[model samples]
Target: MAFFLILFVLLLLLPDAYVWLSFVRGTSVLWSVLWWLPSGLALAALGAAAAGWFGNGLVRIFFFVLLCVAVPKLLFTVFSLLGRGIGTFVHGAAAAGHVAGIVVAVAACGAFLYGSLYGWKRLVVRQTDIVAADLPEAFDGYRIVQFSDLHVGTFGRDDRFVRALVERIVAAEPDMIVFTGDLVNASAAELDPHLRSLSRLRAPDGVYSVIGNHDYCEYGPHGSPDGAELDFEEVKRRQRELGWDVLLNESRTIRRGTDSLVLLGVENVSRPPFPSRGDLRKAMSGVGAGAFTILLSHDPSHWRREVLPETNVRLTLSGHTHAMQFRLGGFSPCGWVYSEWEGLYREGDRMLFVSSGAGGTAPFRLGAWPRIEVLTLRRGTR
Candidate 1:
């Protein structure tokens, strides 16, 4: 926590200094004060949060305020640097650059506001078709609705969003519903308010889910390891109450007529800095080698790290990336961290689908809008 706080402070200072030197230093006293006042307050909030003086709710508010203040400053700094570099070679370039920076900062402020107010609530549905030679003939044209990274704490007690989401999924009339994970941001209590709304979700086959990194209760204030464990159990119990089959490193077989397919779900798994509790071997123990299988693992990294090299799981579903909740022209900084960040990725006969996520810890989404995925399984080569 201390390391991250220091890093965030450094990030804020760099842009704050750049913008002051380039634009506010020589401006009116009013302009300078206006610039430094919010920056000071943001830093103070950061210190309070790091010192544990604020509660979870206050910390979240501080984070949102920090983003509002920092993002525009960062944008202005980038444009200001470009302008200064150009000013060395061209006349009036620096002045024009300053104007551009201001314009960009204003636009960023508007975008952040809009993203917070409307973008996160604007749920979009994406449809994908998966064709595999190994798919069961009876399961052809099976429509599965996949939603992930719900982060229910973002909604507080409001069931409106979940109700709307459930309505949308029900209207689609999918054969099955699969949730990739991150059902809550930290604790099981977050799921309480939306239990009724979420329970409305139904499918002919069943609703299946697997845990995500956040479901472990380690990211938030759980008091102790025992408390975290209890909270985790409560999360699973609530999901089961909602009629969801919470698969924890387990497999289930779905039979249609004489044809059958395997559905394997594992606990959260990821490379370092994140937890890796999934045991793919254990999940597949009783399954036949040739059975067409769909694996639900929270992190997309698990698909390449274990599934591809070790198992014949034909299709993998995941939702941990969230595209950092920001994207432009099909690109995001999340790509720098996750090789298969969003959308469908295929390697030979195996495939993985990563959702941009239906909800998140922060109530914001830019070009990477919250989404629900409708995938159709077809029994043929594409």
Candidate 2:
């Protein structure tokens, strides 16, 4: 955390320094002094927020402000650098580069502002079909709705979005509903406002959920380790109160007539730096090897690490990546970190679907818009 904070500070400073040297230094003394004020204040607020001096809402605002300031400055620096490099060969290229940098900076500011204000609310439903040769005939057309990473703390007391989300899921008429996790950001209290609205979700099979890394309440400087554990228990208790089967290394069988398929859910599990509480072996303990099984593991990495090699679980649902909450032309920085960042991925007969998540801590998204995923299970080759 300290490394990243220092790196971020440097990123912010380098761009501002470049811009000042290239354009602001020659201006009036007053203009030059005032030029650093916005960046300075934003940095101070962000530092305070990181130190736990501000509430979640204020922290989020400062974080967004920092991003809005840094990104445009970075873009301008890039343009300025290119202009300087080209100036040796072209007579007027340096001045043109400065002009281009200013234009791009303005456009970037607008884009960041729009993303902060409205991008996170642009919800979309991503539909996918999973085909498995061993799927039972009775469960052939099962439609399961999956949503994850709500981070309800980001919503605070606003239940309108949660209510609308419930209505949308109910309208889909799914056979089952599954949440892959991160129900709350830092505390169970964050979910209090949305519990009633979330309780409205229902399906014939059931609504199942598994914990995500954030649900453990260890992300921020909220409290002590013991308090985090208490908050985690409270989160599960509230979800259960809403009629959700909060599965923790457990499996439940959903039967249709004589055919049955196992629905297993494990707690948050991932590589180092993220919590790994899932016990795949315990979760799959009693199941037959040949039975069709679907596993809900919050982190996609678990599918590769445990589910594929150890169990016959044919399908896995996950949603931790959020595609880094940004993408362009089918590319996201998340892919560099997570191989199975979003959408459906297949390897032989096994499949995994990673939702870009229904909500996130940062109230901003670009091309990788927030989404609820509807997956229909088909009993045949696609």
Candidate 3:
């Protein structure tokens, strides 16, 4: 009970603290700086009111924002302390705050606008040919076209981009195509109009997918929000309607004359102690320990925990971080947020590649552009 009381107080105070620090502290000199601080605080209040649920841990982004809100303010304080004495601290701090706000406001706003314009200008389709064999013999050079996070209902509700995205993927004529996850932003309800755009995708081998955390939020009754009111059953139904073979702790085998490639998929995972929804053990149930395998995982951490140590999955494909929806620096941009924001990584014998994702969500992005990837996996003599 005491713990609940303390959390309730923090919940109430977090937003107000943000309000005071943003608007009241800066004296209106920093517009962009003040706007986003409370945007996150507001999101937190909504999340908290929704119960600050942790079944997904996605909502923690708001709290993450609350922490980043202080970065600019703290940067100002540090600059002021460096330049002036104790007597001049207050005045210098205010001036420094105003300056930092303007600089950050311009930088962030510029990047945001640029990203938006970039998203609409053209949604480029990348074609990749994957070859997962060491010798150019069995299945020498294989092509795997990948579609990661398309928040499907994003970028001005534009259907044309989706159509173009599919068109490009189809044009590549990939032997196989896989959608790692984040097929939609909030729910399947927004997908009806976007369905045709999705229908454009076709690969001779097949198109398969795994559920992203967003899908869970929309389909399942969010354990946090109103007892997970989202229609999960409907989400899965829609995935089938779109012609995707959604895999949940399941494996599919893709074949050519005498060779077969195994594709195993599971639910989204960001950190550890994940639920055993289609764990490696069950997915690879009856295979010879050395079967060539490709796992369509939604998060990269799964590679380290399940794929690398436990299973024989040589490659894992995933995309949930969205590079934090914005890339920020040379000094640990990932430190500001979650790990594994973007790109390919290696963990011992296993290889994991994280797509930059395919679209924006909620109309905000910075630094990183939207992307589509073509992974040409060849069996290298490692």
Best by TM-score: 2
Displacement of residue 54 (Cα, Å) in model 2 is 6.3
How many clashes would you count in candidate 3?
A: 17
In the order shown, the candidates' Cα RMSDs to the true structure are: 2.3, 1.8, 6.0
Indicate the residue-level lDDT of 322 in model 1: 94
Ranking by lDDT: 1, 2, 3
Expressed as tens digits, the lDDT of each residue in 1-382 for candidate 3 is: 5697577556545544654664466566575456545555645555554663432234334433433443443444444434444336455655665566557645644554555445333455554444344423555667788878777655435677777788778877777789988776655665777887787677787789998776654432343554333454566788788788888878887777777778888877656433324466777778666678888988776777667777767778988777766665633365455455566676656678888677755444455556678776666553
TM-score of 1: 0.93
Candidate 1 scores a C-alpha RMSD against the true structure in Å of: 2.3
TM-score of each: 0.93, 0.95, 0.73
Model 2, range 1-382, lDDT digits (tens) per residue?
7898789888888888977886789899998778787678778878676676655776576658666777888888899889988999999898888889989988988887777778888888888889898899999889999999988899889888888888889999999999999998888888888888998999999999999999998756655658878888899999999999999999999999999999999999988888889998899899888888899999998888888887778899999998988888889999899888999999899999999998888788878888989899998987
Estimate the overall C-alpha local distance difference test score of candidate 1.
0.88
lDDT of 3: 0.64
Off by over 4 Å in 2: 1-3, 26-34, 222-225
Clashing residue pairs in candidate 2, if any? none
Clashes of each: 0, 0, 17
Model 1, 284-330: lDDT tens digits are 99899889999999999998888999888999999999999989887
For TM-score, candidate 1 versus 2, the one ahead is: 2
